[model samples]
Target chain A: AAFLVAPLQAADPLPSWNDGTTKQSIVDFVNKVTEEGSGDFVPVAERIAVFDNDGTLWSENPLPFQVIFAAAEIKRLLPEHPEWNDNAAVQAFIKSDVAALTANHNKGLLEVLALTHAGMSTDAYDQRVKDWLATAEHPRWKKPYSQCVYQPMIELLEYLRANDFQTWIVSGGGLSFMRVLSEQTYGIPPQQVIGSHGQATFEMKDGVPTLTKTLETVFVDDKAGKPAGIYQFIGRRPIAAFGNSDGDQAMLEYTTIDNPRPSFGMIIHHTDAEREYAYDAKPKSSGKLITALEAAPTHGWTVVDMKKDWETVLAE
Target chain B: AAFLVAPLQAADPLPSWNDGTTKQSIVDFVNKVTEEGSGDFVPVAERIAVFDNDGTLWSENPLPFQVIFAAAEIKRLLPEHPEWNDNAAVQAFIKSDVAALTANHNKGLLEVLALTHAGMSTDAYDQRVKDWLATAEHPRWKKPYSQCVYQPMIELLEYLRANDFQTWIVSGGGLSFMRVLSEQTYGIPPQQVIGSHGQATFEMKDGVPTLTKTLETVFVDDKAGKPAGIYQFIGRRPIAAFGNSDGDQAMLEYTTIDNPRPSFGMIIHHTDAEREYAYDAKPKSSGKLITALEAAPTHGWTVVDMKKDWETVLAE
Candidate 1:
């Protein structure tokens, strides 16, 4: 909340952003909304910007990072869960059998998620996640997951924050998982990272109090859940929303297609096969860009073609 | 984020806090954590201070302010729910029958809470709550609930913020309810307010999306739930915590009883019956200074006796 008095630099806040309408729109909107005495000028407190984590801020290609982490964690914990030896899916995961995991993907994924995340004290689980992140790398890129963030988007986060907007991450991924990396990667603090959460129980362990996670999903923040999560976590509607998938459709609608206030919503079109993976109209059950993409034109949402608009992708 | 650089005022930030050991302890703790080269220096990101809302920040006497609002909300919505006429507790509530409402308090209170809070879209409920707050007054004080906040605690909140600490409210009140008033009443924003929450469902109503409240307690942020809720909402452990009740015991213990960083846990002893209301060791379930009170001396918590420690109660 404290910023030293410094003159605004002539240098662009979003250096990674290419010279395009996609970037121009953001700069123009921010300038318009922040100009004092202008009709569009918003108070500092109401300048909330929400960004979806999975693809909007970083790459979620191949599979969501949390899913990847869950699979790896299942492999690591397989030695402890000896009873799962009879299960084909568990064996497939342990053996890195993608075919079997895909065959029983739902069942397999559920076991991995439940076994790896639940049943531990939150403090212990945080340490486990921290340990995992220190060593975990993306399957295709082989880079640390933390460094997989989009440089352009990272610039955007700093730019918005510098202009007095509090940037938040609204994701369908586990809240616990996203919180661990939000501050480190995005400069968005843990409190501002609202996502799906599971039920937790409080108990005393040897005279010390601790909260243990349960397998039950308390909230699944996706699709419509995005807006719901935003509403729950932040009473004020975000004036700016960014996302890359159909999961963020409602949030974008809630932001730009709103009844009141000047708002902006943008979708990062993952259309670069060279720099990054490209797939928007994905298979069944994927939050394919069909609905959101189709409606983007009328809502005035900026759909950034990654191949054309981005000068660079990864932070590196 | 936009505050002009000014020299730190030599005047005390907490003028309402009388010169005493309790006030000095708070000052010392903050200085130790914030001074750059100090052994206990905590980074600005780790300077999180949590406060229990009801009695800690304001007066919760005569009934928690939320319960009072719920009772009033029940009266306002009774016309729509004409069947409530058959309920004696509802009738007593309507006629101000303290005996009847108190006798069947649990069931009656549940009905009031469910009828008033559940079944409405969060936006509509927020509006309803806002409207009620715009007009409602504390039954005893005959003043707005927002105006009843403690002057000393308000100073403490601002003081901590000025010292580079992020302040959060961890309350047992409805998250939605507290959020509606938090920003307006306290400097804390809705995102910084963590409290008990009810289950809500995301749905589309007439082509517009809305999150509807459900009649289920997802998490109750009292007692053990305090620490659990803190861990859920704010993954970082709080370095400083303040409360006025036994319900806050677990949180105080979690924050300051035993931890790595230099932490401070302080309790506001409501021992000024003349100025406010004095009732410690409150019957079985109140925020009676019992478990927390007993543990404070050994844990080095600063217990503030309102009559002696505060120059004034409500901010003038």
Candidate 2:
């Protein structure tokens, strides 16, 4: 004589995602990997999922948010150095012309960053970045930049974590810049962040231990650098990866195509002009989703069309 | 009326640690922070503890184990390049005189590492290290180096983790070298390890993504570099720090001294010659405990006397 035992109700794993194949694929992949005694079941320790920061998690549109922050930094420092205007790139950025900076394929952006972000102790620079993030707002959204993070992806990050995946942010964004808001915004702590970085020399200035930030490019984590960064930091190939652009193509290829595990790759396509912005293989889009968009079919990557796949773009 | 119930039995947290102030202090600190409705309670997420690898967690003498691995690597690579014998350092290392290498104060050791360990893909190097560990045995103990791990510290790590503290290893050892065995040896995964690293370039080899190791010295996580490495990798300041040498002094200072938390710093003093090799404040010792030995008392740091505090050293 056995009494019927009621099972605990499972909440929506991804509350913001619409009922579609993109969401269903993600759910199926997670289920297959997590089910104990199943053929595709992966141990919890190997359940690693990496995410590209700029476009995948938040709006990198208009431009990647760090670019805007660097431009603003240039504007802030412009009053001290009148000679900065003589530089064509600096002048172009100050005038609010995104194409002038983007025209050089991020060379101008790197130059702007070098001019504004180096030559200070990491602590001092941390304070400055903290100050900027406190007041910085997106131009089109008219809200704080942190608030512009996609609500659907936030749910996804939590969902992956709930499924025993150690979620990480593998970004092309400056390590210092993203570290400021990563923990608070995405629930991914700083230790879990792997990104592009500038060189810093460890020295004792006035007998006080300090890490002096230098203007040297040590690692630029984009395109091919993504896989390298992952190996250097995580030391294991991720079981899953998510990104939105060709810059993330190397990471996606490394994750889904190479690893022996039952892995997942995803690309968030900005196909909703009214909700977000629709730009793929276009001239003006910051996150140019071209190679990844074209290769998604062959790799079994889930391409999430923002308009149809996301029930909510941003949290109210 | 309520029936009286016996309190749940508490498991002994440090079975390897003898009943003394050293063991008592650890229990007191953990209790203060974890006690519910207590004034000193710290949230579980902020409970970070960092341990220096070599002497703190395992044996560093007769030498730090990684250096032994590197010397062995030099010998293995000698057959490929006959001309390397011309170099005084390589010739000295081949002779197996630890004094010949240590006399140069890590400069010669670094040369040995760059010559033998670099120029291969990280994956290849990882496999080589893995292969070496599988066959290699400690010279003095006649056991695998992985078996030399301190039993008391293992208990401490488990005790901390059970209480929600995330433990990390900020070692002066080679990053790739330590990662091969960290998960199996210490229960700390590769991603939790922050150590010295050399530069590597990312390139596709016949359409396969590979990271080619280079000879360039990118970072050395020692002395002041420990704090800097912690900052670069973890981003957040740890609340608990442990070490056994002067090399870890800065990390302890950065973690316990600077951060505004109820932090703890403990130094593992090598004073047991009967059960284990004991050498601190000596010229020949690689993990020097001189400066840190003197600074411990002033910082309210706990000094674990190996002979007195531990009932056993290695795991049974």
Candidate 3:
């Protein structure tokens, strides 16, 4: 028993996490599900954990990273495509007017995405995203967008993987957009990243097969759509869910409520304006953490205060 | 070097496959990719192999197993819901009239699916499929549908998996239907099985979160749709693809043609009329292999003549 317990005690899987109730809760839940012969022990094959991307795993302050990427892409391509100059939505995007860009239910944002994301081979689109990620730096962090990921969240991901849990990203971000950086940034492979996707048409072009992305809208993986996406994509229920906004409310409910196996849910409360941008109830962009934050106590979900619970915010 | 060579010579990964050019080609491909310091050596993470279900992995002669399961479900539920009796499609299905069942481009079969597959919680649908698999037997084999898998194919699945290749099932079968048996029969997990799927609506029913299956076509993973489904589900292109009919032509092309790395394509020809139902130019149900079979020669894809290449057909 001493030999068995010593290794777990010595190794701090969540080194970035402060020695507080939040860290203990994660460890306790993992131990309960992984301990052999325990009443709550889940089989290795059933240990699925899902995470939301934008504000939960990384910073989403001024705007969601993909929106910024889309805007920059339009700017980069404007010289070649002069027709876009006359479009109001394109103009709104270029002017950095968030109100106009997101008004009328993200009409401008969708237009920006169509110009940048559609009518290209999937491979070509992937390269464009990768190039943007490599070159683009967060305005405030002064780090590459990929490096804006939370150090504490990265530790948790690794810890869960160490316990043989299959981690997946269920986000509202574009599927192709997240896939380019998923493996390198989060250790989650492309297949494990489920998000909003556009219709793709398969064709043999110039003696080579190609899947061209189209502007046709598919399911958006957020809120209630998260659970539906999980069913269609993951095929089974996840026992653990994590998020930072109201967009993940249905996902958390799906993971924890009435689950046959013991489940865990956690909310990442952006409470440290000094270390990270703090916004809730009225955020700057994208993430609105009102309903989920209110429901956290009733559902017995862990509310992680980033200012107090994290010893480190971002990687050095 | 002698000790290392001894195990390689001693083990036969494909015992059910006869020692011939077909088997040799498979071994050669595996060796080329797995050997270290070789030009064709692909990293383990990039080695993804996709397989078609039905005629490729198991028997689909009298009908696709899913169609048969749907018919059986209709009969089982007919007594409780007498309203189904007045329906012509339901009557044709119950009477075992294939002509009427598949007439008007499978209009009747679609009705059968609506009655059996939709209007239930996804969890309940999964249970129904499992129960049907448990009770239903192959008409000729007299074995459970789950046990009707091909022995040689199963061995091939194991061999690829042993070599650090991630195996996935990209089939035209229902997603929820195949997921119930994929892991148990093929050792492929639920998330790894990509197939035709129905739209599901997520809601809280009596305070319990549920995703109910809806009679809406989300996607049909067949023909050109195969490559599209792969783009949406798997993200990256697979290094290898396996299938038996024309439905997989697009998938095979997507896997092998112009891939930057060494790739493989194989077709399982149902030439053994005695052991398995043989149909290529025309199949009774879904699989029709004319174009793909003719194209195989041009593409240099291995064509496995089932009667000549396989030493074993179904599991004993």
Which candidate number has the best DockQ? 3
| Per-residue lDDT of candidate 1, residues A1-316 (tens digit) | 1244344436778888889898999999999899999999999999999998888888876667787777778768778878888877677667755555666546776666777889888877878788888998887789888899899999999999999999998998899988888998899888888888887777667877677987774688898888878876777788999998888988898887644668898998888889888888873223468788988998899999999988889999
State the iRMSD of every prediction, in order shown.
2.0, 2.1, 1.0
Model 3, A153-266: lDDT tens digits are: 999999999999999999999999999999999999999999998879898889799999987757789899999999989898999999999999999999999999999999
Q: Compared with the true structure, what per-residue lDDT tens digits does model 2 show for residues A1-316?
A: 1333334556787989999899999999999999999999999999999999987899877877888888888888889999997998898788867767767576777678888778888888888878888898888888888888999999999999998899999998888778888998999998889888876766655645577777664688888889878877888889999999999999998888756789999998988889888888873646877888999999899999999999999766
- Which pairs clash (backbone N, Cα, C closer than 3 Å) in model 1? none
What's the candidate order when arranged by decreasing TM-score? 3, 1, 2
lDDT of 3 by residue, B182-281 (tens): 9999999999999988879999889999899987756889988999999999898899999999999999999999999999999999999998978898
Model 2 chain A — which ten-residue stretch has the worst lDDT?
A1-10
Quote the lDDT for A22 in model 1: 89
lDDT of 1 at B115: 76
What local distance difference test score does each model get? 0.83, 0.85, 0.92
TM-scores of the models, in the order given? 0.93, 0.93, 0.97
Model 2 misplaced regions, further than 4 Å: A1-9, A80-89, A102-107, A201-211, A283-285, B1-7, B37-39, B77-87, B103-105, B283-285
lDDT of 3 at A147: 95
Write the number of the candidate with greater lDDT, choosing between 1 and 2.
2
Highest TM-score model number: 3
RMSD of each: 4.5, 3.3, 2.4
Candidate 1 chain B, poorest ten consecutive residues by summed lDDT: B1-10
lDDT of 3 at A108: 85
